[model samples]
Target: MTAQANYNYSYDLNNNIFYSGERQIPAYELEENEIGTCEKCQSTILSLSYHEIDDEFIVTGKCSICGNISANIYGHEWNWISEIFISHFFGQTPAQTTEDSELQIPEARKSLKNEDNGIDDLELLNSIPMNQIETIFSPTEIKAMFARAKGEKCVRQYLYNARKKYKTFEDVFGIKIDI
Candidate 1:
C-alpha cells in the first residue's frame, strides 16, 4: 500500500509523533478523536464499522444527528493501539501475548543472506514513502549505491554493504527496517 495522501492529523516526521495544531496526540488518541464526533455537525453519537484492506484498517462512522459519514484509514504499524480500540468498540477482549520471545541470531543472519541475493532490498526500499527516500538520496544516487553493493561476492559482505545506509534511513523515516 502507498502512503496516505491526506491524514486527519499532521505527523511530525522528525519527532515520530502525530499532532493537531500544537497538541501532540498518541495513535490511540488521534483515532479516538477522529471518530468521536461527526465531521459535519460535531455530534458524538456515531455508529462505527471496521474494515481491513491489505495492510490498512479503516473505521467508518455514521453520525446519527446529521447523517454524515466519514472513514479514517490507518497503517499496519499503528495496529498495536488500533487493535485495542477496535476490540473495545466491538465489545471484545484484546488478544494478549504470553511472553516475549528471544531473537534467534542464526535465523536472522540466514534471512539477511537470503534477502541479499534477491530483489527484497529494492522492494523493501520501495515500501518506504517516496518523499522520505528522496530526502536522503536522489534516484541516481540510490541506483549507484545498489550497483556498488551488488558487486560484493560474499553474502555477508553484500548484506553489510547494502545495509550501510539503513541507520540513516531509519533516522529519517522514523521506522525500524530490517531490510
Candidate 2:
C-alpha cells in the first residue's frame, strides 16, 4: 500500500483546528499582552498575535513604535501553561530572552526589587536582553557566545578565533565569560 493510502490525514478547519505542536489552541485560548520586546528597536510595547501551524504555536509581534518584529514558538504542551509562568520562564532563560530591559537597563546590575523572588545577581546578569548584547556585538557573534554557553564542542575554537581578532565579551560587556 502507498504511504498516502495507509495513513489517514484529518483536519477540521471548520472547527478551527490549529496545532500548537500536538493539540489545537483556539483563538479564544490565545493569550494577549504576555509581554514581548522588539528585536530591532528594543521596544517593549508590542502588538501581538498567535497562530498554529502543523504542530507549532507561533506568537508574532511588531513594535508599536519602531515597527520591528519578533516571534516565539510554543509547543502544544506550552498551551496550558499560565502566562505568568511562561513570562518568568522566558524572562529568566537565555533561549528566548529579550534585551529591552528598558526600564532595567540603566541599573541592569541591580537585583530585581521584588523581595524573596530568589533570582540572584548572576541570573539577572545573564538575563540581560539580547538586544542589549547586540548593541555590543553582531548576531552571529552573539550566537557564538550562546553556543559556547551551551557547551558545544566546536564553539571553543570559534570563540578562540574571535578572541584573537576582536575584543572579547569581557572587554565589551564588562563581565567575564567563562565559556
Candidate 3:
C-alpha cells in the first residue's frame, strides 16, 4: 500500500502529520479566540486548534466526529509555515520571558484592538431598535468577518488606515520581520 493508505494525523508521504519537526505544540495550546465550546457539535473541546497553514485537528482518531479548523495568515500559507516560527509557545522571546504578565499580546484575544469592533458606531447602534440589531454583529461565534466590502485586503491599507498609530515596522507589530 502507498503512504496515502497509511497516512495519519502524525505523518504523511512528504510531511509529518503531528507537524512536530516545525512546531510541536501541546494539545492544550489552543489558537487565539478559539476556546470555549464547539459551534457545530456543541461538544466541549478536548484540545486547542493548531494554527498551521491548512491545519486541521481531529476530534476522532479518524477525524470522524468533528475537527478543529484553521488557516494560514500569510501570503504563502503552508509554504510560509516552513519559514515561520511556532509562535506564542514557551512564553520566551529573544528579549525575555514575560510569562507572568497577563497583558502580554499573545495572552489576549483580539488584542490588536482598533476603534472598530464591527460596531463602527456603538452609540448609534445602541440607539437603534432590537429588530435592527442584525445591522450589528451578535459576537456569537468567531467574531471574525474580514472587511470584504472592498476588494482583498492589502497590508498597505491596514497601515494607511491606522495612521500615526501605525508607526515603524517594529512598533506597530511587535515583530522584526524581513521580506
Candidates ranked by TM-score, best first? 1, 2, 3
* Per-candidate local distance difference test: 0.38, 0.39, 0.26
Clashing pairs in 2: 21-55, 21-56, 98-129, 99-129
As a TM-score, model 1 comes out at 0.29
Q: Where does candidate 2 stray beyond 4 Å?
A: 1-31, 45-47, 79-179
- Top model number, lDDT: 2
lDDT of 2 by residue, 105-138 (tens): 1113333332233433333335444544566665
Q: 1-179, model 3: which lDDT tens digit per residue? A: 11121111121211212333343423323333433353335544332243333253321111113332212222323222211112112222222223342111221222222243221122212222223223232332101222221222435544233332323322422322111
List, residue by residue over 1-179, the lDDT tens digit for candidate 1: 22332322233322223332344433322223335664335677342445455676555444456433344566876442231111001111122111121111100111122243232333234324445556666565555444443442344554454467667766644433454
Worst 10 residues of 3 by lDDT: 1-10
Candidate 1 wrongly placed segments (more than 4 Å): 1-119, 145-165, 176-179
10 residues in a row with least lDDT, candidate 2: 82-91
Q: How many clashing pairs per prediction, in order?
A: 0, 4, 2
- Which of 1 and 3 is the better model by TM-score? 1
